[model samples]
Target chain A: MPDATQSMEAIEQPAVIKRGSRFSGYLRAISAMVWKDLTAELRSRELLSAMLVFALLVILIFNFALELDIRTRETVTSGVLWVTFAFAGTLGLNRSMAVERDRGCLDGLLLVPVDRSALYFGKVLGNLIFMLIVEAIILPVYSLLYDVNLFHPGLMAVILLGSVGYVAVGTLLSTMAVQARTRDVLLPILLFPVVLPLLVAALKASNGFLQGFNMEEIWPWVYLLIAYDVIFIAVAFMVFDFVVEE
Target chain B: MTHSSDRRLTPCGVKMIETQRLVKTFGLKPVLRGIDFSVEYGEFVALVGPNGAGKTTFLRILATLSRPSMGEVRVAGHLLPAQATAVRRCLGVVTHQPLLYGDMTVDENLRFYGRMYGVRNLQQRIEDVLEMVGLMALRRDRVRQFSRGMQQRLSIGRAILHDPGILLFDEPYTGLDQEAAAMLDTLLRDVADRGRTVVMTSHDLTRVTDLADRVDILHKGEIAASVRRGEVDLAELPALYFSVTHA
Candidate 1:
């Protein structure tokens, strides 16, 4: 213990305590948070596996129940894909925040000196990555099972845009819900209604791309998706500090 | 006994922590009523109280984990809620929960926190902190595999990783065995010896008497009594605590 005190002095008056500029520090904190989440998930495999399995199950169930012919599958592919993504995304968002809450790591994150929004953005980025990964895997599988081409460029763009909007709002809502005992059920109840506008836009744009509709036909929904993504991201950034505050 | 109005400052005339008329409520129920509290630089003040006395609430507010419903709170000379980021940079907090990631190894946990704090020369600092907490041998082990004592020790390492000037600990000894608690005592002394102001909340009277330079009793959301070391005999602390809290 005496030696501990001696070493403590070394930390107390380091010859040089090099901290990055504020902007760099903020970026570093965000990246660090993302890295922590990714690393933890890599080890546990709990969050991604659950989301992927759930996503696959949803696709399989839709395949059997809808039993769509090729013509009908083309029309319904967008709807089915969006539903699968939304449900899987909700699972990922809920589990991610729950891990933080259960382990008291959320408080640990809040204690950092960076703007609380940095934490919010970091979680958002992490959740977006997980959702994209799940979607990437689900895309080819859904195509195989339903025998429909699901990889149009415009459809990809819609997927990315939709994911951004969904995750941005889901991340914020999950932060709020994680504080509640009924968080598992609370997130979807809060998220689906709030995210409905963006989801509708995504579904429309995706359908237009699949149906080979002209740019003029798809432009409005694309614009709506873009608008919703930006607005939700900005809103989440502004209110995240208040949402996480106890 | 020091009253809330006394406002005792360190020899250098600085209050490391000060709160005036701090009030906190949860929904409709009040947790912390109008209360004033302060700690000087390098002082170790143990806040003892019965359950629901608002000791955790008070420490959480100082740690900036909870917003005081109403108060003028300052830490390390910076007003809180306004300069909270500045205050956070100067504070290291250890609550009852370890606040560590289970899947991450001890080394990775420190590295992650090091990055979050933007601590320079992080590798060397992590090594030093691991050594200080006596967890150097288990650096690569997953935190979930650790015993309760080991996790608490790592929690201390995480708290001190950034070398903050003030530490707020809430029931750090909870769930620790006799040996682990003694080890924590040594660490606490070493920390205080390094000139960091500390405010700790504990239910253990004997341990508080041994480690705290001053003891403040909180009862029903307010300071019921306060006494510096040597002002009261160590043997009578339990009696003092009971009389204050039960009164």
Candidate 2:
């Protein structure tokens, strides 16, 4: 048997405490988690490739189905873009969390000595970054296909706001879905209903930007997007601990 | 809050683990009946039981991975489900699953956990653990490419990365070849020798006899007997286990 006193003395102890305040430590943990996902995705590219391919497929199908002439193209571009993003964003969000659950990474993450909310934010940021990267690639492709400059600054802002709200809610709901028996089919059903408000606001604000509407005309949708993002992110942060709890 | 003077002190404090009438249930099925168990600092306790005997449930509660329904549970002196975060800081758990990202290399996986724990001088610590697990050469290899035994070794390395005061092993040797099992035996012995509080659950009575100072037979959500290593004959564990469980 091991000697308690001898073992205690032999254990290597840290000479200094390098930790910052609780808040900074929490933030560092969150960033570390996000970095973990990004680096993993950078290497595997499974989630990104799946999402990008799916987005392009949806866009390609829409190009033939809509047959948008110049007049109709202007009316349909915003709707098509937003719809593509919503569907593609779900793929990234579901896979990002599902991979964690399947690979036992979620349990490993839960065991870390950080706030649960930090884990939630870390996931949210990682999903958000992946979504943005897919959109960044899709935007130019859509621009080239439609012969329309989709690089407007206002439109970009709306996309960012829309993604934040979408991922904030999606990340929480996906955690729940991943634990279910029917998770493959359950996420979109659970998510689509709850996310209608954000999607509506994103579509309208996107259209407002695409049409070059005045701030007064576009403010309502932008305001709705901002409000949706803030409310969902806050709610997800608060309720995330419960969602991941066994 | 009574203190025992005979208890040995650890780096953290005395009384590494304590529980009173711990109970756990899933829906209406009670998995763990009211049971009192405690482990002192630097003790190695093995929980052995038949299937569905609540052995894993008990270990899970200690790991702070699962909550007990009705009991006062404290690990490393922190109340569970209430101060779980504080408890997690002092605890290391090795579940049946490897609990590692296969997509990342061994080095990357350790780096991620090292940063999450805010470990100081993390690079050196990662190198140390890799060497400890005998995976220094495989540090840059993807975990998905490693054999099951290698992955298990890496998982052990991951758990000890933070140097937790308490370690919980849940069927860690479930699926390993003879070579891996022998390597794990050596590693477990090293860990036990370090005098950290270790609680392991396994059905291998013969194996547990060699490692554990005390073997607890948990039957139907209750501890039927606690056999001290010094009192019981190692070769007679199977018969002793059957007599008590059958009764």
Candidate 3:
């Protein structure tokens, strides 16, 4: 059914496809990054296992280090949980980015035909997934140990907000940190400072909900969390091209 | 002037990477100073330079990993700066590190990159590349466990899995033992035979003399000499390379 001359031309000197016009190319690029990170994680269990073990260990140490009385638990729960998450998030982010840099996979990925934002999303999603898996594992374990049901609807929302915030800034900062001479140690130092807004908002929201605060008491924190997530994600998306550019 | 037609003989029926007056500087030290170069669709061109001659800088520019301070670069007609994303869509890169996740199995790494490159039928492509690299059996093993040579083999597999029309290698064969290097050489030749353009940077002139269709000497941030493969005797090349850089 094909035209003979056109087919011959295709065989002799095939035409290359343009990176599709429209947002579809952007969507495709994003999916490519996400798919790449998730598949790699699924195969190796590298980042997840490391984060999970680290999270559990943090909770265990917190149990001994901090008094478990009801009053102390109420005030410290959100702070304690987010701190653990922040710490664990860095562990996964730094390790993953460092691995990419050390192995020279970053170079290969950069050579791909996609916008650099795709790389940012791919790494962020991968890191977020790893952090969430750790959180999921930690929640039940912490619930059993602390006699608190961490599966509250509000808490889940807070975790999602916190993670989105953490991942957004963490991905961007980690990209920069990985390129520096100080790689592994540099990620947390860099990530924690930029992500304070996300941390504060999520922590406040999480704690307020846990203490059964009124709607008026909780709305401010929730607003802050949403604003933090959206703003940082956008900033991260914009700056990604510069960071990945050689 | 007569040799200009000879330059056109290679099968890169269309140019893969073409640059005009490309300039890049870092920390106020200019690396590529208003340089112009092009690699045809299937041409095997070696960017030969001493340490700090800006070979890597130029390759990075073409790869869209770095931007030039100024100039025009077109990768397969994808106008650079404005259309780097478009240019990146068609190119493939193999660098010194292999750039794979060490904790993941080889299959996972390949599948991830295949998706990143938007390669259709990713599984089939991964299988074909693995088989080509002779790493089909080790697909389940984590890359962290592989030796330096084995890792490089997988790196090559990752780069070629997408079947990019343009393949850029930054000292890809540097760390390999002889047998592995030979395998890499044969694979590169096979890729070239299929009409893929390749631009590689290397320090070893003996190997470059044997492998490159043409060679360009980059010295002190500019191309100092350009020679066809058969023109150079190996003994005189180091002197030429050193003198160019020094000059």
TM-score of chain A of 1: 0.93
Please report, in order, the local distance difference test score of every candidate based on alpha carbons: 0.88, 0.85, 0.78
Clashes of each: 0, 0, 8
Q: What is the TM-score of chain B in candidate 2?
A: 0.93
Instruction: Note the residue pairs that clash in candidate 1.
Output: none
Model 3 ranges with Cα > 4 A deviation: A1-32, A42-46, B1-14, B229-239, B242-247
- The segments of candidate 1 whose C-alpha lies over 4 angstroms from its true place after superposition are A1-17, B1-11
Q: Model 1 - which docking category?
A: acceptable
Mind giving the per-residue lDDT tens digits that candidate 2 earns over A163-228?
999999999999999988899889999999999999999898888878888889899999999999
User: Comparing candidate 2 with candidate 3, which one achieves the higher lDDT?
Assistant: 2
Looking at candidate 3 chain B, the ten consecutive residues that score lowest on lDDT are B1-10
* lDDT tens digits, residue span B1-247, model 2: 1112123233333567889999999999999999899887777889999999999899888877788999999876679889988888777788888889989999999999988888889899999889898999989999989898899899999998988777899998898888888888788877776657889999888778878877889999999988876587666778878998888
Q: Against the hidden true structure, what lDDT does model 2 obtain? A: 0.85
Candidate 3 lDDT over B46-137, as tens digits, reads: 89988888988898888888888989998877788788766665667887878888877899888777666656667777888889888999
